[model samples]
Target: MEVSSQHLLSNEYTEVYRRLPLKLQLAYGVGHVLNDVCASMWFTYLLVFFHLVLQFNNWQAGFMLLVGQVADAVSTPFVGFHSDQSDNFWLCRYGRRKTWHLIGTVCVLVTFPFIFSPCIGCSGSHQWAQIFYYCVFISIFQFGWASVQISHLSLIPELTPNEHDRTKLTAIRYCFTVVSNLLVYVITWGILHISSGEESKIGPGDAPKFQHVVWTGLSLGILCSVIFHVFVKEEGALGSSDVRGTSLRTPIADILRSVEVYQVAVVYMSTRLFVNLSQVFIPLYLHETLDMAASALALIPLIMFIGSFVTSMTIEKLNRCFGRRLSYILGVLMGLAACIWIKWGSGDQFKSSQIHIIAVLIGAGGSITLVTSLGITADLIGDKTSSGAFVYGIMSFTDKLANGIAVVIIQDLHKDPSNTGYYRDVLTYVCGGSALLGALAVISFLKKVRGDPLGYENVPNYNSINSDVLPVATEDIQPSLIS
Candidate 1:
């Protein structure tokens, strides 16, 4: 009996992996890498580019980012809703979610070059022109990114039904994401170091170097998209053909009516708020407190990548051992401690010896918090009644909202350059406070979700009818035929 049980478990594992085509798995992994590379590089360095290279004031730079995130907040959920409703969209050809993916890819390709283009002329009026250009391009980029990100996230549950497999797959994707972040750090730092011939360059007229870096990123984005499209095969839609139109009012009503979804969204938003707020301050902290050069600042992402990579590799084991809720609490507490240490204990000292150690601690703790939270999101989605697209859309929207709010708050708080000490203190307070709140929310939600295991019994299964071989019902096809 023991041997038979073991054999059955092994077979289940094999079947889980086999559910996704090998090419699709590779494409998914590669797509994550590309996505993070673009996102991390731009987000981490864009403020610096605007402030140091383009000569924008810190508030202006922060506000631009704030605007972009606001745009993301508005667009993500709307797109997800539309995509979820579109029955004949491209992804339906194979019953897979490929239509939105392809559309998102094309949008990225189109917007990428414009993102890199130098908007300001070399003449006297360049500064204002550059600002105008930055705002436009950044908005466009964010819009396109929202479409891609929401659709990509929505695809996760569709890709696999097994909970354990989903966890493993998520880990693999995060690993690739970390690697991409590391590469961006190394490459961009090298470029900045080489171009400036100094530790950091200041002023607005230095547009050429900035343009080159943006172009390089654009090129990489193009290559990554191509690779993803070539390898990934999205699964067609599953189950019954009752094409019921999802009521637009339902999502809003769900938001108001479902206590569970509201609680989850709040936790998600609070956690994101804490993380993003802290991230915005890292560069400033490095610059002011540690006196680190721009090249060294690049090491921030590298450290974060390493931490995220390690945590992702062992996430399943960690989840199994600690349980997701307790794990998140532990991670958030650790991250909070690190932030406090850096802010109160070490901010004034500015020692090179302490910098690396602090970076590692922050990175490790941040990674654990991020991964555990994402895992919880997957769990929540699995438990919910909504479609995969809608769940991800809601999550994405909440995150963007948090980010937008964080940017505005941080920007307003940090308007005065002379009061660096106060700024640091405020950041510490805000970030630490939010983390604490998120931990509390996680604890509460854990009580509600404690007994559930990842499974698909709750979801409708369409595979029994051989989704791939079934002919798509067209307008001309008789409804009677399908019945």
Candidate 2:
């Protein structure tokens, strides 16, 4: 009887951790399309909508973004914590992560359109009322966004244990993200071009263009998510055990105490600050500093996404060849060069062609940095699937909070929206400075990981992994989880 039981257990273990099928990977990759599309609008267009179409000043626009970020930051841990415990919830029988994903998806689809739509029952004279109205919806939208983001990201660690597979998954997921961003920019460019006038500045008349963009994004996101839920399936809650024969659920206290955790977290956070802040300011730079037509807003970003799409497609091979840290530094340097060009080479003349090249650099740099940072994060998580959501939650907390505070500070620097010079300087410094800092953080992270530069030594052997279901107590998980 004992021999038979061991044989059955061994078979189960092999089945759970086996290489993921191509279809499963593709499904998992598409799962984030909802968040990606909405986020493209949120980061790229939120400020533009508030400041331009709704007539909020720069401060007010930045404040709205801050509100959403705070909400997202606050909600992330709760959703992550609860998601890790989804096995206990009856409603999560379909899947703990998917249940939260469904809830978040519903919240986003319902509230997101209203965010870009007219502030019903409030006119331009009632500025505070409109602000309050937006605050409510933005808060809800942000919370939902966090839920989707945390759950989806946490799924990466849960789905596979192979480092190469994890890298592939992360790379594939990013490709879909790039595609989502491309779709949104295309939709926005087409709508703005067809609907709006020849004027460079976006005005109240362009409100409907934004509405069309959000709805189209929401609709496409819905379809992708449906395919995700249908094709992707979660195994049993305890998950495949590590080769060390330990439980998948490492204690939260253990995770928090690891130096490696903080290392990857910093890299992840700095990368996000670089990507998001640059995205927020890019449109404003084009419209205000370059004095390009409104179409430039979508066209420039469209070009950038094209560059990112190409990078995402090829990054897996680059990562295999160059290693994570070197690849990340390469991306950072590219972004820094773009920032330098923006600050000096562009000059006062509206040289549209040169700016498009700069856009490509930004996009390519952003793709490599984001993918490698996330790949490093998955390496950090390894087989600790239970706390994966919490780890991601904490990382996102720092990213969103820092980004919010940064935006508020940057926007506060120039109270007047028409003051393009200060804003221009701000963009160059924030984006360039962040990329440099992120590169430094990556270098620092390697030193902290002891002899394991790639941090792959922490991962257990996949072939011998067992799923015996031994959940460790906090006191039992030693600090050596990192070393």
Candidate 3:
């Protein structure tokens, strides 16, 4: 006898998996890999690239990074606002998100050549010219990055309505991200080795070598973008005809009017500020204080990759056993501990190997912080609104903005070239303090929602008259299946 309908509902979930389109499945798997590789490559290695390859001073390098991040911050929100306003924007022949993805791919292809171009005939005052070139190229690169990142992230919740499926999907995406992180670390190390002769000595003038490496990376990035565009499918559309026709001004007003949006935005901004400050300083600490080789510096990302891989594999279990809020809190606390260790511990006591071990532990904590916080942002948006694209755009903007401010603040703080030791000490204190403060803020927010499992109070009803004002909910929204 065939199973009854109720029995099938109760016993089978594999059917749901089978129902997903082949294109979606492939895109889901590949997108994360491509995004992680491309995104991390710039942030993780660019500092060293500028310092060693470009021969820029620490302050100068930091400022350049600051500029790129600031540009990212400004551009992301505008993009988000525009995206929310447009209907079938990505749906014109090519998929909705796919069109932007292709555009970003082309942008990367065009920009990579500039990044790798040699310092030939660049003498006298043209030193500034070289710096200007690098900065502009990086800024443009980030613009393309933000476009692809915001659009792609916005696609996630729309692809599936099921809360459980979203979590599962995010986990899968993170797993690929880990793999990409690892691949880039290995590849970057190899490229530097081949191009530099000595890992520590490569500077800005080796344009030919840098160009070769960047071209290869850019080609790979373009190929991945194409795969993503061709395979990824956006499943849902904005429900209301009015919403579809809504001017960009409407969503912008709506986003601005929402209080929860600002609250989430503040949290994202503060957290990113704290975390990235620490991240930016890590290479500086390794290079100046630890006097480590570039090859050794690569271990930082390698360790982070491993930690992310482990987290990706076990996130479901962690979320199930400990509620998402607690899991998130734990991750933040872990980051706090790592920061404290690096800040207060005696550096001279540890050998190079021991230092690397410490770096790994720190990396593990940082990995946890990154993955959990990002998941929380998605959940926060999900609990509050059905408009996934708009929410994701807000989150992305907050993160990038925070990064921009943090880079500028840290760079400005470390402006004195004469005091290397003092600079390191200051970086340690700032990073440690920021991490602790960020954790506290997150904890405070979580405390408000401790009793409310669904956090429904956090969601504001747009139809209400006072809806023009975003409200802070009395109860924190519970991290739940809906989020």
Candidate 4:
């Protein structure tokens, strides 16, 4: 009876999997473009906007970012827990994950524009009032951002059980992310070039340009979402042979007890901290320390993302050739080298060419580590598809909370006028330090895996841990009877 049941389920799984066309895959990948674009601006330009355009102090700007991060941290768990519910809520008629994704898309589309626009009723209000106004909008936008991110990510395990397919999906999603970020930089570059003089720095007059960016991102995001909803069906994505029955949500206690979960969490958090901090500070480093013109703000980041785009395209092949561990270590070394160069090699005086080189290295390194970490996360989850959202949520919770606090502390130090080259120090020590620590954590995790392959019993298909070798070839694994 058990064998027969497994056979029946396998047939159903194959049917559903086969029906998932390439167009659907492409649409699914494009689903998160809005979040990607918003994130680029939030990290790259939020400080610049608040401190320079709105005349907020360093602490104020940092606090606002913290507020958004806190909001995101808080919302992730709720979205994850609910979206994983086996039973349908009213919103789940369209599919549970899709419903949440749509809800998040709506919330972001409606609220994100207000963040960049001048305060409507209180444009000239007291500083505290303006701060309060922006905080409310930032919180809402962040909640939406988390909802979109977690729900979209959870769709991966549900969509298919094949590891290679999962990797392909993740790679495609990240490729879109790179493209979305590139679009943002290109747009910002074009707008800044036309709106301001070459010598002038970005200031209050540039608020409209941010608004323009927000609107463009929203327009593109909504269109892609429509395609996703139309093409991708979530029908065969849950528990049971028919894929319409209840899936047992993995208990939070079970998730907390898993050692591998913690390991992946550290990697994810550390990678995010490295990438986000560098992005946030690069514009400031250019404007304040180097005193580069407005165009450098966009041009430099553009170069960086171009490098990321190239690396992202090739990462899957790299992962196949070399295991996740070696690939990630290589990337971390590249990032560390970039950090060292920014710190000492650039010195008090540097050439434009040197900065461009640093940008490419940073971008390439960040892309590899980030992509590898996320792939590791999918592997860690293995066949535990029921609680996939919750796993992703908790990881993000740690990432956001840590990054928020780190940024706050960094900004407090930045507020001290006596400190020269503070941004440089931040880029070198803080960002570089994160890469080194993350590398250490990766080594620690591998050691633990080697000590006991069963350390992640909850994760059934950790091939990397199961064998002496780190990366299992794609063809060596068999498809599971149950998804």
How high is the CA lDDT of each candidate model? 0.61, 0.81, 0.57, 0.80
lDDT of 2 by residue, 436-472 (tens): 8889999986656635565333333232335433222
TM-score of each: 0.81, 0.89, 0.79, 0.88
Q: For residue 347, what is the lDDT in candidate 4?
A: 49
- Between prediction 1 and prediction 4, the one with superior TM-score is 4
Residue lDDT tens for model 4, 222-284: 888888888878875522222333443557787888777888899899999999999999998
Task: For residues 46-137, write the lDDT of model 3, one tens digit per residue.
Answer: 66667776666766777777777777776676555554443645443555555565565566556746654554466344667878877787
| Best-first order by lDDT | 2, 4, 1, 3
Name the best candidate (by lDDT): 2
lDDT of 1 by residue, 1-483 (tens): 112344334432222123555566667766654456557745676677667765667777777788778777887877777666646465556433456666666666666555444443533565667666776777776777777777666566556544444565676676777777777777766766776555674346556655665666657766777787666655442211222322222345554455666667777777777666666677666676556676666766567567667766787566656667776777787778766876765543445556566566656666666666666666655522234566667777888877766766676667567765654675578777878887888777667555533211122222465333322222211111000
Whole-structure CA lDDT of model 3: 0.57
Whichever of 2 and 4 has more lDDT, that candidate is 2
Could you tell me how far off, in angstroms, the CA of residue 333 lies in candidate 4 after the best superposition? 0.9
What are the clash counts of all predictions, listed in order?
8, 0, 8, 0
TM-score of 4: 0.88
Instruction: Record all residue pairs in model 4 with backbone atoms less than 3 Å apart, i.e. clashing.
Output: none
Evaluate model 1: give its TM-score: 0.81
